[model samples]
Target: MIITHDLTKRYGRTVAVDSVELEVREGDRYGLLGPNGSGKTTLVRMLLGLVFATRGEIEVLGQPVPKRIQDVLPSIGALVEGPGAYPHLSGRVNLTLFDAAGAGGRRKDRRQRVGDALERVGLAGIDRRPVRNYSLGMRQRLGLAGALLRQPKLLILDEPTNGLDPRGIREIRDLLDELNREGTTVFLSSHLLAEIDAFCTRVGVMDRGRLVLQEDLSSLRAPTGRVTVGSPTPERVVALLDGRVEHRDGEVLTVRHDDPGALNAELVAAGVTVTAIATERRTLEQVVLDATTTSSDRVEAAG
Candidate 1:
């Protein structure tokens, strides 16, 4: 569980995280979505107490953060900005050192734990090889193995699939799903909207450091059917629909009506001379763009 109220972080008058209030409930597979440098990472670091907020409050797992961060850390596993390893060291060696470095007094029979982590991330056999020789995806998995070394109860991953190919991404996704099903509350951050749509139970959209929307994925994606109505009588059709239309371009009217047949029938009854009627729907990408896009975002991206 996590909660933040009016949380903000600033660097020399540049606001990285601005008044973000976020909550993650128990058993939530929550995804944090945002463009690059949109404050998602800053917020995550604050949650982990790795970065201090410029203003406002933070709590994690029922304790005030940074203060009780120690009390809650054993329960949390995190992979932020990826993991680093000695280029010359074997994957197994790197993980073993990491285990010793931050075992948090959970240092019992760590050799077996390291083996389990490497096996869990699909790096068991190859782990004895030098990390410099491993593929990008393998290194990413090595980072994941480090996070899993302790069998943490809460997983906080930032762009966990950052450089993986499709197959590797799917592997990571499946692993996260398995972990979540096994009762680890997951807080994931990524630019991969489709992946989030596929695996996340809840989502938070961020733009310019603000949390613009937070909602359950099922309800957020509830089938709101759409239709494209193009008729010679476009004006009359618009009047009939009463501005339920989402888009209008020339002769096409993109309306958000679930029952296309009923709408067509109604239009016919009104003598609207339908030329075209086609179904459409919104994707998570569309929803996120609609929710977070702003003039500033475009300007910032352009800059």
Candidate 2:
């Protein structure tokens, strides 16, 4: 439901986003993974037309951005920077004002929309409490409620779990999961790998103002069992096992082996002294770190 072609944004000589071409299909719990200052917010802002892009095109819900942003934006619910509210206002009052400020939505159903949003985010019980009295996690939920007040077709949450405790984080995760299951397209940006691993169906990793990797979560985590064989004669052991060694540093070797048992047997036959062999798998954390590390190395080398 969202697409960007060669989209770029720059401030002076600093490029916030560089030639980003991205697509998030309908019903996708797509995660934009990146560290802070990696253009996650910039990209989202450009999509929302809050900040104009320096170049390229954007489309949301089949309508071109900027030109048709009004049409597309009304149907999109976003909490880019997080929730903002009148500190003195009660929770209900705050939500009431937020709903009323919406560019679109039936005026008659404002009460119902406000109540539904509050209940959805578990803020209904604190109706009379001032926002200033609410905890940070509570504020996060409140902001989420405002974004979801319109029951948008697409929900864009940038760092949805920010300021949330573990429990609050899980609550938001479940809420997003339910929303996506109900056919809302969820596009979220976060640096937390565990959150993406648990919540996203697909992910795009951003680094140094560029999209470095994008893939299905399942495909990325497929059972490609790896082994770190610590052996005195690591070279002979790898040669005997005919294993595809992907990474090697010092005497430590990481080899891709479908069957560690078979590889172990070959190593034993070759009489290679093995000190350690532990079955391992790549986690989403590793994938993101590797991508960013490689990109940093490349940039440093060129400099």
Candidate 3:
């Protein structure tokens, strides 16, 4: 439901985002991963029409951004940077004000919607408490509740897990999963690799104002096994293979290869006297780091 073509943004001479071409299909939960100063927030702002792009086009929910942002934005709910809340106001009062400000339901209906949102974010009983009195996690949930007040078709979240505890993180993860299952498109920007791995189906990695890589999380995380062999002469065992051997740790030699049978035959033929053999699969974090490093190397070489 979101598309961008060569979306470039600049602040005077400094390029904040460069030729970023992206697409999030309907019902897709896409994660935008990047480090600080990587222009993720700038890109999201351009998409929301809060900031203008230097060049290129952006469309959200079938409408061009900036040109028809007012018309299109009603269908989008977003939490950028942090939750916008009035410290002095109680949580329910804050949502009540937002309901009045947005164009969604009648007064009574808006009240009901507010209550529903608070409950969904697990703040039903504490809505009467002032926002300043709430913890960081509570404030995050409150922000999410405000976003839900609009009953948006697409939810754009920027670091939704920033200050959340493990429990709060899980709650938000489960909530996003449930929303995606119900057909809400989620476009999430996060620095937490584990959060992206657990919550996003697809991901785009950005570095130095450019999109380094984009891929389906499942494809990126496809299992590649690692076999560790304990032998007397680990160096000799590694020499048996051309260069498939990765490293030697203490008495164990770790080798990564897709075919287990080939590895075993080669090890036995080398007469290394294997004492123990163990296999391991790569986790999402390892896969992402590998991809990011490869992208960085390619960019450096191209430059």
Candidate 4:
């Protein structure tokens, strides 16, 4: 649903986004992961035509951005940085005003649309309290409701779960999953690895303003040629495995086994109590650490 080529953004001599190529397919829950000062927000802004690129091209929903952004924008739902509203107005009033100001969607259906969006984001029965009284989580939910107001084809979100508790985060994740299942392509930007790992089908990692890695989450976490065996008797497992055991720690062993099922059966037949056995795979954290440098916010004295 989105693509960029050698995209760059600079502020005077400092580059906020370096030459980067990005691809987000239709129906993809694509997560953009990066540290603070890594230009993730800048990239999102460029994609939405909120910030013009210094160089290169952008296409969203088959339309070139900034040039034909208007034609495509009405089909996109976005929550960048955070949601905003008239602090003194009720949530329903805020949405009504926003809906009236935005493109498309009929005037007569505005109330129904607002109600549906609010209900979808868990604010169905919200009182007419002014938005200034709403908690942070409520505000975030309000922002999400705004994005869903148009029922857009694609969603571009940045730090979407900020200020949300565990339950609220899960609720948002489940909501996004349902939307994706219904064919809404999502482009999410956040620093949380676990969130991306749990929700995104594909991921892109950024560091020092550059696109360092992009891949399907499944491929990036492909199993290694190893199995982790957890047993009460670690020594017994090590002895039974003979030369196949590579490392052992307490009751856990990292064995050079290709199949976990066969290894489990062997351990059971040998009277070794196996607590757990599973094929080892690269974690999303490992993949990210190997691909990117230190967080851009870190500073060190000259060596």
Candidate 5:
């Protein structure tokens, strides 16, 4: 649903995004993962045609951006930063005015759609309340509702989980999952690795204005277990592994390998009785940090 080839943007000498390439397929819940100033927001703005790129091409929903943005934008909904909610206007009226101003939908259809969206985001009962009275989470939901009012083919969300409580986060995550299951493409950008790990099928890691890694989450998370064996003499176990040991944490010896059975057998054969055999797996946050740090190191070396 979205593709970019060497998409770059520069503000004078400062490059915001550098030769970045990305592809998000239809019905895919893709996560754009990056830290602050990592060019994620810049890339999103470029895709929305809110900012023009200095070099390269971008296509959204099969139409080239900028040149065909007007034609393509109507088919996509986005909350780049957050909601442009009118503080004085009630939540319902905000969406209503947007619908009318943007010529989004017929009056009757718009009202129904607005109601449905509000309910979908769990904001139905407070529709009459002015946006200023809403919490940060409510404002985020209101923005999502407005974005969904058009029923666009693709939804691009940035920092969607910001200011959301655990319950609100789960609600949004479930809603996005439902939308993707029903064939709506979701391109979500967030710093929350846990949420992405829970919902996104694929992920892209960016650092220093470049997309350093993109992979299927399942493959990236291919099971590898870490075994920490506690023993009085940990060096015996470490020596049994032929220098494959990672580190010694007091009486505990940590070894990381794909095969746990072989490690266990080796430990038993070596006559080191395992006091505590605990298995550890890498979390999404660990993977992301490793990837980004590696990318930064590579960039530094290149420079």
Candidate 6:
């Protein structure tokens, strides 16, 4: 649903985004991963036409951005930086006003739209208290409700779970999953690797203003040629496997095996009591660390 070709943006001599070629397909829950100062926000803004690029091209929903952005924007729901709300008004009132301000939805259906949005974000039957009284997490949810007011085709979110507890985060995750299953393409940007690993089907890593890596989450998490086995008779397992046993600690053995099922069968048939066996896979954390340098916020003085 989104594509960019060598997209770049510079602030005088400072380059915030450099030659980023991004591809987000329809129905993809794509996650954009990066550290502070890596230009992820800048890149997202450029895609939405909130920030213009210095050179290169951008097409969102098959329309050239900034040129035909108006045609495509109605179908997109976005939460960037954070959500904005009128602090003095109640959450429901704020959302109602926002709906009226936007283009295209019917005036008669605005009330139903507002209530449905509130329900989706876990604020159903919320009281008439002003937004100023709501907690940070509540405000975040309110922002999300505003984004979902239109049942958008594409959701572009940034730090979507910023102020919530674990339960709230999971709730938001499940909601996104449901939306994706219902055919909404979700493109979110976050620094939390675990969140991306758990939620996204595809991922992209950014560092020093460049798009460093992009791949499917499943492919990036492919198994290493090894298996971790837990056995009570560690000595018997080691002796049977011999050179295949690369490392051992107590009952746990790391063996260089391609298939865990075959290894487990072999051990059981050989009278080695196996407690557990599983193939080891490269973690998303390890892959991201290898693909990108230190967080751009870090600074070391010259020696």
- For model 3, residues 206-293, the per-residue Cα lDDT tens digits are 8888887788887776656777778888878777776878888877887887666677787888676778876656666676566554
Expressed as tens digits, the lDDT of each residue in 101-156 for candidate 5 is 77376766887887888899999998999899999889999989888887888999
The model with the greater lDDT, 1 or 5, is 1
Models 1 onward score TM values of 0.82, 0.82, 0.83, 0.95, 0.85, 0.95
Question: What's model 3's lDDT at 142?
Answer: 92
User: In candidate 5, what residue range of length 10 has the lowest lDDT sum?
Assistant: 294-303
lDDT of 3 at 259: 64
In candidate 4, the residue pairs with backbone N, CA or C atoms under 3 Å apart (3 or more residues apart, or in different chains) clash, namely none
- Model 6: lowest-lDDT 10 consecutive positions: 97-106
* Candidate 2 structure lDDT: 0.86
Against the correct fold, how does model 4 do in TM-score?
Answer: 0.95
Flag regions of model 1 displaced more than 4 Å. 104-108, 223-256, 260-281, 294-303
Model 6, which residues run further than 4 Å from truth? none
Candidate 2: where is the Cα deviation over 4 Å? 223-256, 260-280, 294-303
Residues 13-121, candidate 2, lDDT per residue (tens digit)?
A: 9999999989999999999998888889999988888999999999999999888998887789899887889999988888888777773389898888888888999
Per-candidate Cα lDDT values, in order, are: 0.88, 0.86, 0.85, 0.93, 0.85, 0.91
Q: C-alpha displacement of 236 in model 4, angstroms?
A: 1.3
What is the model-wide C-alpha lDDT for candidate 4? 0.93
Q: lDDT by residue for model 1 over 1-303, one digit each (tens)?
A: 999999999999899999998999999999999888788999999999999999999999899998899888878899998888999999989988998998423667778889898998889999879999988888889999999976788899999987799888888889998999899999999877888988999999999899999998877765558888888777888888887978888889998888889889988997788998876756788789889865333554453
Over the full model, what C-alpha lDDT does candidate 5 score relative to the true structure?
0.85
Every candidate's CA RMSD: 4.8, 5.2, 4.8, 1.5, 4.1, 1.5
Give the Å error, residue 276, model 2: 16
lDDT of 5 at 301: 43
